[model samples]
Target: MKIIVTPSQPYSDQKPGTSGLRKKVKIFQQEHYLENFVQSLFDTLVVPNDAVLVVGGDGRYHNRQAIQTIISMAAANGFTRVLIGQGGILSTPAASHVIRKYKTFGGMVLSASHNQGGIHGDFGIKYNIGNGGPAPEKITDEVFAKSKVIAEYKISDLPLVDIDTIGETQFAGAVSDQTFTVQVIDAVQDYADLMQSLFDFKAIRQLLASGFEMKFDAMHAVTGPYAKEIFVNRLGASTDSLMNCEPSEDFGGGHPDPNLTYAEELVKIMFAGENALDFGAASDGDGDRNMILGQNFFVTPSDSLAVLAANATLVPAYKNGIAGVARSMPTSGAVDRVAAKLNIPSFETPTGWKFFGNLMDAGQVTLCGEESFGTSSSHVREKDGLWAVLFWLNVIAVKQMSVEAILKAHWLEYGRNVYSRHDYEAIPTEAANSVIAHIKSQFSSLPGQVFGSYTVKLCDDFSYHDPIDGSVSNNQGIRVLFTDGSRIVFRLSGTGTEGATLRIYLEAYEPDSAKHHLDAQVALAEMIRIALQISQLVEKTGRVAPTVIT
Candidate 1:
């Protein structure tokens, strides 16, 4: 084999977001589009001698081709070994775990989390550092800078290695006197073993043995195989309890997001009034986000994080107690109250797992989560969907109580944070910017303004100063705080491929147990109305209702 150096030109739109670079499948299929970005990343990295690299994706469209290209490039780029998931598949969290488990230089995760999948649907790629976490902004910035001025890329002339089977394939170096290796592995084994080491499998097995029924929805995405291995083969769950547990390149013609809007089938089963199952959970496309539910009840992600922190001692790994907790700014303050009760510090950072990675690496936080149906602990840098489900199961086994009962008891002790998020997706970029601009125009006069039972106390764009690194991240989101602990937050999301997404977050603290049973929509009706009025969202964007409500 010989090294091939091809001249290439830069693509101006290669800047990555808090997540990574995401675009429509057609955009990535362009000549040298994916190659340019990957080569830019390689150019920005300092490869160590005999360095190992991990490569995998969610088995979406174009995944195999992208992996083949990356592998050939790795050999030419001086990488000694590459560990890839069998059949070119690996969930985001699983890829992160593999990177940390093997101490690889870094890993490339090819997944557009919770996005649609098809020939015309979304695709993405991100770099995870050796810490098993998303690359910090510093590295991403350098990669972006390199991408802007890249002139060529390096690749080997060797044939593509087989990624369908679990085995190792070796080849001579393209330019050096070294050998390169590609090893395909069972993606579920390492992640499952880590789960067993963290929770009490025996107790959970007993709970299932006692006829405790539950259901897991993989939404035809990557988590299908992981759930099958962990919940069925390991935990003895019947195959009937798993829904959409088949991997699909197009996600079975459905959006693989685990929200109530997309996972309606699971919602119907869990909220069947009386004949509902004991528990129900669903994971997103790449298996990094999770939604938890009980018989006739839905648990908000904010509440889920608080409840987990409150009862983390039930699990064997966290039996010694947690160090601290952190949450994204858009998430509710429920976890803060739990942290106060546990006497552990709580941190609020901008939206991203990299921020939490910093705190965890410094031994400042053990559990961290975001409100977008994502939660996790120190066990893995990225959010683990199956791990969160197992954690809830372990807690249920220890308490020997129903999911509703546990949540009610938690609310009785820590009070309820009635919260909801409204997403207006795929709107024109200019329209979304108009809404933000309109909201910001009133920031100067909104403070001390009175509106019904709520009075505005603060209004500004949220910013964060990282305590560990002292780096400041500004323009996170817009916030309007009320004296009664009610909040309205507005931000433009970068997760979508087309246009822009305007997200409005409404939250209110309810300390009274009597009002805890009210529906979140009803509890925050006034606040939502005020939020719409303040931002003039409908007038600015011509959207009568949000695309999805959570």
Candidate 2:
């Protein structure tokens, strides 16, 4: 096949958000649109002639087509090797593991995580550095800047490789000293091996065989194959234990977000009185985030992180000890208590997984998470869904306790941080900006003021100075701290594709064991009322209630 240099112009709006550049499928289908960005990434990466690039997606619509284009473009760019998952499918966490395990230069993961996927739905691409984490802001900014002036992109006229086969295909004829190679790999094995090394699988299998009923919902997304292989084949769980274990491009027309709003099917089944199982779990579209449920209990992501940190030593990978821990700013303080008890450093950064990458790389943090249903350790560099699942199972098998009992005991030891996040999605950008501006304006006057039953202790816009790199990020979010240890935080969601999403996080710490049993909403009712009144959220947004509460 001959290499073709296709002329093209730059495309605006190519900048990546908190995660990646995500847009409707139509935008990506435009002539020379995807190529311009791909070329821009290639230009910014500046990989070697023999460098390896791993490419795969979440099995969404147009995933295969995009992979074919990338393979051709990689070959033309003088890359020697490319590794893609069979059928062009790789969950976000699995892709990260493959990149680290292979020591590739970097990787391209095509996934709009937790977003709907189809012809009209969202498609995305994220570049992960050789460390198996999302490329830091510096690299992403360079790619965006390059996309504006990119002129021509190189591509080969080779026919598309059959990605369904797990084998290597080599390009022929005159070229570089070494032939370009594309290898289709089994996606689940590497990730499974990593999980097995971290977990006590034999104990989990014994628990399953001794009548521990459980259910894992893949949501018909990329985790289907991973879960099917790990839970059923390796753990000896029955086939009926898995739901929607076949990857679907459109996620069966569902939202594919593992929240109460999107994963309602799992919620309903797990909440059923006598029909509930011993354990229930669900993974999002790209399989990084997770929602853990036990019988009728829904363990919030913040709680899940705290639980994992509190019991990290139970797992084999962390049996020695965790170096430290971290959490996104909006996450609850549950983990902080654990960190304090263990006498380890606990760093808090803005709301993105990339912020944790530096800490993990520097060995300052072994476990980290955000409030957005994400949790992971130093394992690979991204939030891992199945890893959290197996951690919980291992804890249960060792303690011989139910999820609720474990939570009660944990709260008894570390107190309770009741937390909730309210998302008002798709608000006009201007309106969202005005809301944030108002919060900033009130910061000076909020301190020493009383609203409802609480007196404000302080108010300010949050900022973080990365200890590893000494880079500073300011105004990450607005927060109001009360004298009673209650808090309210407001920020704009950076990952949404629609209009700006306003996120309001509320938390109240309770040390009294008797009051821990109250409903979270009820326990924080006064603080919620005061927060809404102060922000004038109803009048500003013209929406009485949040779009979604988690």
Backbone clash total, candidate 2: 0
Candidate 2: stretches off by over 4 Å: 173-176
Which pairs of residues collide in model 1?
Answer: none
Q: Candidate 1: misplaced stretches above 4 Å?
A: none
Which residue pairs show backbone clashes in model 2?
A: none
Candidate 2 is scored at a TM of: 0.98
Tens-digit lDDT string for candidate 1 (57-92) = 898898999999999888888899999999999999
Q: Give the top-scoring candidate (TM-score).
A: 1
Displacement of the residue 367 alpha carbon in candidate 2, Å: 0.8
